[model samples]
Structure formats: structure tokens, C-alpha cells
Target chain A: MPVLRGFLWLLGFLLLGETLVTLTGLPVSAGVVGLLLLTTWLRLHGGGLGDIAAAAQPLIAVLALLIMPGVVGAFFILDALEGQWTAILAALIGGTLLSVMTTLALMRRLMGEASAPGEEAPP
Target chain B: MTALLDHLLATPLLAIALTLAAHAAGTRLLKALGAPAWCPPILAAALLLAGVLALLSIDYADYRRGAAWLMLLLGPATVALGLPLHQQMPRIIALWRPLLACLPVAVLLAAAYAVGIAWWLGAPPEILAALAPKSVTAPIALGINAQIGGPVSLMMGGLLITGVATVGFVSLGARLLGIHDERIIGLALGLNGHALGTVRAFEIGPVAGAFASLGMSLTGILSALFLPLAWRLVGA
Candidate 1:
């Protein structure tokens, strides 16, 4: 019953997101819109919603599994990828390294070396 | 053997069952082997599923018939991220100024480099579009891809690869730069790697995990809202 309640809440928000997207023509995922809406709701409500957390935990834990099939979907389009392997590999490897390095440098510059006040180094 | 394979594939739940089973086994195997942070369970599960599908001569379309049911859950799973983002609000707020400063620059660079490199290499427009949002999580990446006009499946491939590569790169880069701050490391991982990076961040520590979650959520929201507009503005 609790999980069902949580799911209902999630589904309701997802639907709300879908409605917003259709109405406003937002170029975003309904789930993301739902996530933002939920975050806003929680902020306005000023506390955690236990039921939502309960329902969300399992889903979040296996988030990778939820995405695997889509990854596998890549195989379905091998022809499209054949000639583009060079580009794909270059973009993936080169782009990832660039992004990671730039983000690290930026964060290090903007945030500095120290942890936040009252925050000890994580063990 | 062929008859058995056909009947098994014909079963409505076959894809879902295999996916769940493969992921579970992969998780266990990784745990048992003490696999490195970059080698996520999804990687192993993907390999397992791909091998099984190939060995059985099963079509991805057929496998997808059942797997589609599982994919439906991705929306809810993405929404679930709200809980962590909400719970970590205070920490998020504390770091908001720096994070906000870093996010747009980080997000744009992440997308730009991929799109730029691929474009420079004469990759097709479709591939470019797919690469544009590959740094974010899959749900958001797929959504952005749909709006921008690309192969959603290829986008997923890009995302998975990006996630794995970012984790490895971020970890190694952190070490090379002597950056021991978990927050910085975690944010970098999540910003570039998305979900898989978040998973690796958790392995580092709770502080890392929380920041990684925050990083991933913000990147997803920002990309979801911005990438399509950018794609359109570029007249693509």
C-alpha cells in the first residue's frame, strides 16, 4: 500500500510533466519535468516524503538495469554505425576526457581544495 | 535446440526475465571479483544479454517486445532522482553558487566537445545530434535526442560509453591533479558520466555519492531544458 501510494505519486507527477510538455512545448523529458516538479513540491512542503523515498529507493538502486535494454538497442542500428565508428570512438574517448578534465579544473578553481566548513574528508 | 530457443523467445516475459537475471548476475559477479569502478554492472549485463541474444539468434526487435515493458519504468526511475536531490537540498544550497557557476560551463563543454569532434570528423548530422546530449543520463539524453532529431538508441550507446569513460577519466585525472576533494571529484564524475559515474561516486564515499547525485540531477535538468533549444538555434 505504501509503495503503491508512492508509485501513484510518481505516476501522477510524470503525467503532470507530460501535460506540461504538451501544453508548453518544453523540449525536455517528462520524467525530468516531473523530477523538477517533485523537487519543487518537496521544497515548498519543507520536508521529505517517506512514501516517495521508500518507493524510489529500489528503483534508484537498479537504475543501471533500467537503462541496459536501451544500450542494447544500439545493436539494432549497426549499419548506421559502421562507417561512423571512427567518429563515434573519437567523440566518446576524446570528448569524455576533455569534459572530465575541464570540469575537474573548473570545479577545482571555483570550489578550491578545501571541503566545506564543518565537512570532514569523506572516509 | 532451435525450437526451444524460438519458444523461449516467444514467451512474453523472456526479455524482461533475461534482463533482470543478467543484471543480477552481473552485479554479483562484479561484487565477487571486486571489479573496478568503471566496470559497472550494466556493462556486464549488456555483454551477457548481447551474448545470449546472439547465441540464440534472437532479434533485438523481438527481444525488445518484452524489454519495452522494462524500459517503461525508466521514467519513474528518473523521477525517483528527485528524492535524493530533495534530501540533499541543504548541501546543494550550500554549494549552489559554485555549482551553478560550474554547471552551465560544464554541461555545455561536455556536449560541445562531443558534438564538435564528431562534426569535425564528418559524422552525419544524426550522429552529431545523438552525441550532443550523451553526457547526461539516458532518460534525459533520449528526450533531448528525440527533440533534436537523432537515433535515440545510438544516443544511449553514447551515454553508456560516456558514463564509463568519464568515471575512469575523472578518477585518473583527480589522482593526477592531486585533487582529493570528494565533492570536486564526485561532481566531475556525475557531470560528465551521469548515472554510471554517480554509481562510481558512491563507491568513493557518501559525500561523493551525494554530490554526484546532485551533479547528475542538475546536469539532466539543464540539458533537458537547454540542448534542444541550442540544437534549434544552430539551425540543425
Candidate 2:
């Protein structure tokens, strides 16, 4: 029940977040704004966000299930997709690689000065 | 046979049931195979369900309409990102300087790499828009697509493919850089892959999971704010 209540609060935050996004013309999506708001509230209130995580864990674990319907809808546009497949493949693979590499490199640099250098190999 | 399949798909329950069942089967298969990265259960489930839908002669729209309720979960799931993020606040705050510096550049690199590659390939505007947020989480990517007037289906597709590729790419990057700190690992995963990246990070350990959560949220927020503005600035 407490977990349920926490989820309700989370939903309420999502509603507010969506509303805020619509009104303010923010770049952040409703869901993301909801994330920030809930994080802020949890930070301020001294309550762990664990309950919400626990409540949502099962559904969240299967993250792909929630969006596959929308993704599969792409089948209807295969003709268009075919033309763009090269671009799509390039973008997804290259973009992810660049960002991941940059972030990891930067993180390593930070860890180098803050702690022992060369802390890469961990078991 | 067509009439029978149509009848089965008539109720919203069928969408829910089919999704759950497919995912369950996929999960079981993965478990039996020791959950290899090449065939994540979710991707397998999506493929299986899509194949099944195609076999039944049920179109995408019909399946999505029946799956509308499940779609509603996207919002809550995005909200759930806050939990893991909150837990990682301390480490994030401690490492704020580097993260703050790295985030915008990372977002820009990601957006630029995607748009440039797609544009070079002569992708149309809709595909360009869909691919723009390929590194962002699904709900956020969808939102970006809506704002940019892109194809939502394509956005979802791009997001999924990018996510699935993220686990492998980040690890490969780490190996090349000789950086195996779980923090870097998690950060790379989350920044590039979003939620799926975070999931991969969790497999590594708690520290990796926590940082990956932070990376996912931070990159999302940064890209959401800066990517469009940069998009507008460059007149692309």
C-alpha cells in the first residue's frame, strides 16, 4: 500500500511534469521533468526513492515491451525506412560509439586525478 | 483464419497478453541460454511479436491501438529513472565538475554524429528528426520526434536499435581505452544507451548501475535542452 502510494505520487508528479512542459515549452519531456521533480522531492524530504523503484521494477525490467508496439509500427513504413536504413544504421552505431567513448574517456580522466590513476581493470 | 485472428485481436487484452507472453517466452529462452548479450530478451520478444503479428495479418496500427494501455507505462517508467538516480546523487555530486563539463560535449557529439551521418546518407527530414534522439530514452526520444514532426515509429525504432547496440559499443570503447572502472563503464552505457544502458550497467555492479543511472538522466536532460538549440543555431 505504501508502495502504491509512492507510485501514485510518482504519477502525480508525471502529470505535473507534463503540464509544466506543455506550458513552459521546455525541451525536457514530461517524463524527464517528472524524473527531476521526483528526484528533487525525494532529496528534500529525506525519503528514499526505493519504494517507487520496487513498485515499478517488474514492469520496468521489461522496458522493451512497453515500446515495441510503437517500434513495430515501423513495419508499415518499410519503404521509407529502406531508403533511410543506411543513415539510421550509421547514426545509431556511430552516435552511440562517439558519446560512449567520449564520456568514458572523460570519466577516466576525472578518476585519474581524484583517485589513483589507471583504475580501469576491476573484477 | 483471418476472421479468427481479427476476433482475437479485437480486445485490448490480446495486445497485453501477447506482449507478456512473448516477453516471457523470450525471457525463458534467454535464461536457458544464459542471457547472452547478442540476443537480449526484449529484442527477441519484439521480433517474435512482430513476426507473429505479421503472420496473423494484423497491422501495426491495430496492434498499437490494442496495446495503448501498455504504452501508458512509458511515463511511469521514465519517472522510475529518478529512483536509481537519486541513490547515485552523492557520487554524482562528488563528481559533478567532470560530469558537467563532459555532458554537453557528449550530447553535442552524439547529436552531431547522428545528424551528420544521416544527412550524409541523404536521409529525409523525418528520418533525420527520428535519428536525432536515438541516444535518448524512448519516451524522451518520442517527445523529441513529436516536437520535430518526425515519424514516431521511426523514432521508436532508432531508439531501440541504439539501445541494443549501446551495451556492446560502450564495452568495446572501454576495452580500447583500457578503462574498466565500473563508474566509467556505467557512465558510458547510460550516456549512450539510456535505460537499456543503465540495465547493462546494473549487470556489472551497484556502483556501475548507480553511475549509469546518473549518466542516463544527465545526458537526457542535457541533450533535451542543448540539442534542439544547437539544431536551431546551426540551421539544420
Candidate 3:
């Protein structure tokens, strides 16, 4: 029952997200808009909604699994990748490296040195 | 016998069962191997399924018919991120300044670097477009791709590669760069790697996981809203 209620909340948000997009014609993801809305709602509610957690945990656990089928579809279109292989490889390797480094540098600069992992966060 | 086989193949049940079975086997194999970070169970399952389908000559479309049901759950799973985001709100609220300051720059740069690199490599416009949203989660990336006229396959390909590569970069690169703070590491992971990075962040710690989700959700929402508009403005 808790799980069902959780799904209801999720689907309800998702529907609202879709409607929002349709009405506003925003080029955004309905699921993501739903996520933002739910976060706001949860914040406003000011208490843990255990039912959503109950449903959300299991799904979160297997997130990679849920994404696999779509990832695997890339295999079928291997031919489309025939000529662009080197470009794809370079972009992934270089772009990821640059992006990671950029974020790290900016974060370290802006946020300053963070305490080590096990320490309690600073107030 | 032929009719029975045809009927079985025609239904989504077989495909769904195969996906579950393959995922189960992959998880077992991963556990048996001590669960390496570089090789996520989902990658294992994907490879296993790919091998099986190739050997059996089953069409991908047929397989997706059933697997699409599994994909539907992603919408809710993504929304479920709100729970953790809410749980971590206090910390997030505390760090809101750095986070807000960092998000737009990081998000746009992540997209820019990817598209820039691909373009410099002489990738065509469509490939560049596809690469623009690769750092965000797949659904949003795919949605942005659809709007901007990139091939779905290439976008998916870029997304999978970016996800895996970001994990390698973050796990190893953070340590190399002397980053001991899991918050920064987690934020970087989620920012550059999206959901895959978020998963890796969870392995680091709960705090890292929470931050990763925050980064990932914000990145997705930001990229989805802006990238398509940016693509048009760039006129590429």
C-alpha cells in the first residue's frame, strides 16, 4: 500500500510535469520537472514521506538496470557510428577529462578546501 | 512447435524475462568478482544481453517492445530522487551559495567542452548536437537530442560513454588531484557523469550520494531547458 501510494505520487507529478510542458512548451524533461516539483513539495511538507522513500529506494537501487535497454540500443545503430568512431572516442576521453578538471578546479576555488571525507560537515 | 515458438516470441514476456534474467546473472557475476567500480553491473548485463541477442538473431525492436516497460519506471525513479534531495536539504541549503554559483557554469561548460571537442574533431553538426546533452541523464539527453535533430543512437552512445568515462575519471582523477572531500568529488561525479556518476557517488558514501543526486537533477533540468535553445542560437 505504501509502495502504491508512492507510485501514485510519482505518476501524479509526472502527469503534472507533462501538462506543464504542454501548456508552456518548455523544452525540458517532464520527469525532471516532476523531480523539482516533488522536492519543493517535500520541503514544504516539512516531514519525511516514508511512503515515497519506500517506493523510491528499490527503484533507485536498480537505476543502472533500468537504463540498460536504452544504452544497449546503441549497438543496433553501430553502422551510424562507422565513420565517427575516432571523433566519438576523442570527445569522450578529452571532454570528460576537461569537464572533470574544470569542475574540480572551480569548486576548489569557489568552495575552498573541504574537510576530509569522514569529518562532520561544517556549520 | 513452430507456432508455439512464434507466439512466445511475439509476446513481450519473453523479452522481459530475458532482460531480468540477464540482469540477475550480471549481478551475480559482479558479486562473484568482488564488484569492480569500472565495470558496473548494468554494463555487464548489457553485454550479456547483447551477446545473447546476437547469438539468437533477435531484433532489437522486438526486444525493446518489452523492455520499454522497464524504461517507463525511469520517470518515477528519477522523480524519486526528490526524496534524497529533500533529505539532504539542510546541507544543500547551507551550501547553496557555492552550489548555485557553480551549477550554471559547470553545466554549460560540461556541454560546451563535449560539443567543442567533438566539433574540433570534425564531427558533423548532428554529432555535435548529440554530444551537447551527453553529460545529462539519458532521458533528458534523449529529449534534448530529439528537439535539436540529433540521431538518437549517437546521443545514446555518447551518453553511455560519458557515463562510464566520468566514473573512471572521478574515481581515479579525484585521488590523483588530492581531492579528499567526498562532497566535491560527489558533485563533480554527478555534474559530469549524471546518473551513472550518482550511482558511483553512493558507493563513496551517503553524503556523496546525496550531493550527486543534487548535481545530477540540477544538471539535467538546466541542460534540458537550455541546450536546445542554445543549439538554435548557435545556428550550428
Best by TM-score: 3
Off by over 4 Å in 2: A46-54, A71-77, A113-123, B122-126
The best-first sequence of candidates by TM-score reads 3, 1, 2
Per-residue alpha-carbon lDDT of candidate 2 for residues A16-65, written as tens digits (9 for 90 to 100): 99999999987677888888888888789756456676665654565567
TM-score computed on alpha carbons, candidate 3? 0.93
Deviation of model 1 at A91, angstroms: 1.3
Put down candidate 1 lDDT per residue, B1-69, tens digits, no spaces.
Answer: 878877887775889999998898888888898876657667777888888888878888899888988
iRMS values in order, in angstroms? 2.8, 3.8, 2.2
Off by over 4 Å in 3: A46-48, A116-123, B1-5
True-vs-predicted CA distance for residue A13, candidate 3, Å: 1.5
Docking class of 3: medium
- The worst-scoring run of ten residues by lDDT in candidate 1 chain B lies at B201-210
Listed in order, each prediction's TM-score against the native is 0.89, 0.87, 0.93
Per-model DockQ: 0.60, 0.50, 0.64
Question: For model 3, which pairs clash?
Answer: none
Question: Please, what are the lDDT tens digits per residue for candidate 2 over residues B1-236?
Answer: 87887898889989889888887887787799898764556667777888888887777778888899898887887787677677667766877888777777776777778888888888877678778888887666655665666777677777767887888777777778887577778888878888777777777776687677777777787777776666577665
What's each prediction's clash count? 0, 1, 0
Give residue B231's error in model 1 in angstroms.
3.3
